[model samples]
Target: MSAPPSGPSLPKPESITASLLLGAMFNWALWGVLGCQTYLYHIYFPNDKAAFKYLIYGVFLFETAQTALNTHDTYIWFSRGFGDFLNFTKVLTSPLNTPMMGAVIALVVQLFYAHRIWTLRKSWLWFCMLLVGITLAQTGGAFYGGIRAFQAGSFVKAQTDPSNRRAVYVWLIGEAVADVLIAAAMVYLMILRRGQSHRFRSHGILARVVTITVESNCATASLAILSLIMFAGIPDTNYFTCPTIVIGKVYANTLLVSFNNRIVLRNLSQIGSPSFSSGSNIVTSSRLPLQKSTPSSAGRAFESDTITYTVHRFTETDSTTEKMDHELQETSAMKGSPSHHV
Candidate 1:
């Protein structure tokens, strides 16, 4: 009789478990850094226009929750102690709670950005609307799918029936698509602002490049996670069990941390620039005139041409100074006093 056919080998559980744990730890660290940076930016330099600190906070929170869920799932698979309970907990907490919070944060950020663009009277409102619509659709789809998976108890069944794993795949893909759209919109906005600065050109370029790179890495990591979910469909006997999921989580978290750091550094540099003081003064003066215009009808009528004049005199003696002041007044009156348009 022919020798019995050799059975397919199972992956070493210890190796896979170790990698997943390490990945989760790294992700947690990254999330902590991101959160800290957000707090710093919001507190120290609240007036920085380029800083959207909340984006980092939202992404960090979601990724941290995701890493926790994955780590728990991997632990349960290897340890086999209360595996069903842990799996159910992850399902209920991650795709439903975490993603919903992230979606809301992202929507608010997009709306704020849209308002900023509208204030500038730019023509990119339609493009922003399209991007926001797609992002909302993807987030909503993923959120609903996650809720269904939790309700159906598919996380417990993933170890047995591979067909029930479609929910995970759908969630991953939806998130990836949303991330890509957001990144694209951000990059486009940066490009639009490229030509408007001279003193801060390098900073703008670096910020835009870093933002694009981080978003691209995030999208790539999401795709990698989706690929790992596909591998989960394979039979346990023949599964190779690579560290793809852990690596994806680590990459995603790292990108978010880097993005936050860049934003903080950029804001600090802007605060130290000379233009900041001048710009603030100009803004203050502009608002003052607008506020004072409503005090009287004459003020309103003169608002368009109300000019403030200043005279400067330099002399070695008081007599010469007085003479110079008189000459300056005569010159001003002869020229009809150049008026400023408010």
Candidate 2:
């Protein structure tokens, strides 16, 4: 194990000022976004699974707490100036907001996706189980690393030890693996579902659904990969942290979008054209409760159902009933009865 030098010191030499500023800004912006997205999800997708709702609420609340903690730390660092911003021991971010929490959030999101996969394709159980195992592995490693790192309170020391480095490495690499597996599995499930169901194939509903899935997971997975690479490549610098800080939020918010986008996908399918041109155009949504879409020019299927009428013929209709009704003006309607006086 490597030990840090004696006596406390400030982080003037390290250029982590940008990291702190950027991380804070990203956290704040994502939190604002998360609020709006949560509102829309509840309002529009009210019929989502109860478990899913609880998961969202849990994440929302937990992340809200995290946001508060992060903000408070930033405030103390900037306003109070009691400790150096770069000095891990002087700063008090640990035990409050750790990457382990992020790991848990990411794990929950993975489990959500795993459930989705199970529902989509039971045959994919083994794969989903693998993902769940990976999630747990990462969570364990991250929790250990975060607690240790926080306690050690020294970035230099944290990276110097093989065990410390191994813990974080396991956590980050596991997270990246989870991302890749989940995304690819989801895409595969969607494609398989459409192929199995002919109706879905003709309407291209699943096509759009696949497109959305790919779009949503692609950004997140790319970030995960990038973060993992940076963490691996540049273990000492704060560069890896730039992505690590916001990645959990990204995972949570992305899961939120994926959950809520189900309703959007259903609505879009109902109003979609029959013909679909995939990859040629993009369906964009603004960052808000409502994301507008430009109508696709694909050909639409117009179903016209015809109702047939039945006609009955009577024999000797004219001869049997020459006059169905007779006028009663003469008051001699019956052959043997006379009409009563009014």
Candidate 3:
């Protein structure tokens, strides 16, 4: 019988870098998708508010920066450092790309959704505030973890330290919790709450909204949970980075897709009504116009609390408004509108 060597143990080269390399490749792939979405958003919603435009472009730029930094670090590890185990051990720029930038992007997206929740239901102000707190806490944890990892100087040290690991736990767990809450809030506010309305349920439009909200948020939350599992289960390897690095991309793409989906929604709205003129106004709001109207030349404008959108022209009649129930008037639809809380 012999005791195993007790000195610092290193993983096989294949295991050590394979996950990281694959993660970086996925990160770039998602970045490409984000770029295309950003361009499409610019073209499709030219009249979108300046603040909205700035947010979309800002996230794109942050993702671009992350991809660039990841590429530089990858080159250092595989090109310049080729065959050198020491080079592979260093933290390099990974902290910047993975937790640092990723956390900031997630925070922005979460807060954006939170604002939407507030806009939809003023009474849910407390819920929105709670979401903001969770998002901010996760971002703080991520930044703290990134700093700790960088200070550790090496993956081995970062994993071995309890404080560093705790920080990571906070970041990932908080992210998952925030994502789930956001999804649930959107579903409840935008879809389920409207279930009582006969028109919405009958048309099945609310069903589609529910699907989109759940699927998008589920994707991000699942990844965060998976990353947490990998980090906890296999502490010695970089397996967790595979999912962690792409989390930001997932968040960015989800937001962009929600924005772009408005095009589809616009088409959906026009399905039954063909009288809408050529020009379209993409309005960001919680209410979608579903109330029936009569024949008139002038178009109808769907207004919301947050952003004003000059929607397509449709006929109007007095009976449509007079016949409407007070509840229906108060509770608007979510069709052909910007995501309620994407």
Candidate 4:
């Protein structure tokens, strides 16, 4: 048999391989979570808007493809290239599933949140523009870094190249910044500003939404920042790949969680209103108008006065009802109006 191929001793070979292995494992685990969330959303919100449903399924399918590619990359490294020390140094595979795919998913999620912010307040056009700009830059940096890595064809070259390293720095920093901004804007607009209004100050559904928003965005931002620190601090190994690999899944999960949360809000509303029924074609909420009747000199002419309540009907087909905050705002506006009868 021909002698096995050999090369110079690889620096931190075990560290690099271990990081890749762990990243692959974590990626698979997060994929499972994404699958479950997507399934739950499908079952719960069949009536969701076509565009909304397409976005949900699109991210999910993209994530699925990435997961498959991750598995193939892992297999190539461990199973096929077993005992090949030199494989650790090489680019080995196109990073289509890792940094590239992750960047796309992050961009999609960040932009979705940006749109949400716009829907909340049209006057915040400047804020939304800034967010979109950062998101695009982050994605551009990630793509450039991936291109540089592919051109280098080896981890050593990629790490040593100033341009490659700079691209990665830009990508990671931008990702973290974008995530933090999205989270902060959401909390401020949805909870702080909305809650300032007496109508939503003590709303239970709003509290739950705030909690989910904070948890999801914080998770992604923390991972991005951690990856940046590790990549910068430990230039000799691939430790950063661990968190970087799972970052895409976190974005996908964030989107799914946002979609699935309508179930929770719907349940909360049902509990708060006894008349609320599930799967009803026409959902109705009645608001009682404030009325003051003076006692008549003739034995209370108020006998003719009758209590009046106006019913606001929301149909399942209404696209505006897909967003909880929007629905709540509409309900509040209707409740505040005076009821006039002909």
Model 3 shows how many backbone clashes?
2
Lowest summed lDDT across 10 adjacent residues in model 4 is found at: 333-342
For TM-score, the strongest prediction is: 3
Over 195-296, each residue of candidate 2 has an lDDT whose tens digit, in order, gives 454443233545555565566667667776786777677655556666767777887788777656554443343243333222333222223333334434
RMSD of 4: 9.4
> Which regions of candidate 1 fall more than 4 Å away from where they truly are?
1-23, 46-121, 154-170, 190-192, 196-342
In order of appearance, the predictions have TM-scores of 0.48, 0.71, 0.78, 0.77
Across 1-342, the per-residue lDDT of candidate 3 in tens digits comes to 999879966678876788779988999899999999999898878767778888899999989989999899889988999989878788898888999899998998888778867776789999989999999889988999999999999988988989889989989999999999988887776545554655532244455555676788899999999999999998678889889889999999988987786655543433333233343332223445454444344345434444334444344454532333222223335432333211
**Residue lDDT tens for model 1, 1-342:** 999999966455543344435544554565565566556545644443444444554555665665566556555654654434233223334334334444444444444444444443357667666656755664564466556656656433433444334544444454455456545655655566555544453444345444644465465546545544544655442121233333333444444444334333333334423332222121111212432233343222223234432222222465643543343333222111121111
lDDT, each prediction: 0.44, 0.63, 0.77, 0.75
Give the higher-lDDT candidate: 2 or 3.
Answer: 3
- Provide the lDDT at 2 for model 3: 100
Per-residue lDDT for 201 in model 3? 29
> Which is superior by TM-score, 1 or 3?
3
Between 1 and 2, whose lDDT is larger?
A: 2
Name every residue pair that clashes in candidate 3: 288-333, 294-317
Clashing pairs in 4: none
Q: What order do you get sorting by lDDT, best first? A: 3, 4, 2, 1
Reference-based lDDT, residue 101, model 3: 91
